[model samples]
Target: MRPSTDIDPAIPLRARDGDVEAFAELVEFFHVRCLRYARYMLGEEEDAEEAVQDTFVRVYDHLGQFRPDARFEPWLFRILANRCRTVRERRRRRESLVTTGELPAVAAEAEGMSQDLLEEVEAALEELPAEQREAFLLRHVEDLSYEDMAVITGVRLSALRMRVKRACDTLRIRLKEER
Candidate 1:
């Protein structure tokens, strides 16, 4: 489930107006989630960190371009998602063998979730197609509306829905089998 991660509506507006402290607040508010999402996407801490840093840098560079009428969550996530894709592509082009993935630090965020269960779920998530996994994470884990997801992913609402559905179905089966 997604956390209640909202910030003040004025934060982005303040940041866009060249408020350095506001921008810092924006970074602080989103850093953990951006890192977590990037980690899930890249499956490595270093890559995730790079993606998140790049994402914030880009966001700062382009804050003036952000539409004031729009919500900040989707816009921030859109940049993060793009950064993940870029980092993933770069990693892929390097063609290096990666034998390990970082354990999710957010595992403790889920109260009452067992370590074994978290590992099983992470393994199952890793087995999903990238598109499906991204869709599932954006929709479920990030608690984004389908419309927001469409803006972030550039995928049609139906396609995003289908991807999330397939991911959930696969996860259900995989988790059940693991148990």
Candidate 2:
């Protein structure tokens, strides 16, 4: 299940003040969603977990750097997204040096569907360019606004919108072909 995206104002305030409990609360709150996004972006459980863990550590270390006026969710996601990108880059580098027989795992768990359809959808998602996939997942799955996505991804609003549009179009065509 996806975690609620709501940010409690007090949590960040307390966390920034070096309250360990508050930081733990923040981790508990954002962990699921971060893991979900990382898993989809990296396509491996171990990589996803590592990314999420790294994200939290960075978040804690940089808590004092957070702007009080800025919304916390976007800032948190921005960090998580960067971690995912780094992990992806590392995996790419490693793959070049050594060929592996591992397959990309499903980004999200699924149920009550034909296994073939699930696999097909996962394959389609994997085929998308990284930017498109991130755009699609952030906009559709995470339900973030274009402005928030721009802040998190550092992409211009127009470019992010175009990426989401292209991602949706691609997914529709690919899934339709599979039918």
TM-score against truth, every candidate: 0.89, 0.86
lDDT of each: 0.86, 0.85
Q: Which model scores highest in lDDT?
A: 1
lDDT by residue for model 1 (1-179), tens: 55556678899999999999999999898898888788778887888889999999999999989888888889999999999988888776633323255565565557667777877888888888889989999988878889999999999999999999999999999999988
Which lDDT tens digits does candidate 2 get at residues 5-97?
A: 768888898999999999999999889889878888888778888999999999999999987788888898999999999999988653321
The TM-score of predicted model 1 comes to 0.89
Runs in model 2 with CA error above 4 Å? 1-4, 93-113
Model 1 ranges with Cα > 4 A deviation: 1-4, 93-110
Best by TM-score: 1
Question: What global local distance difference test value does model 2 have?
Answer: 0.85
Angstrom error of the Cα, residue 50, model 1: value is 0.4
Error of 2 at 19 (Å): 1.1
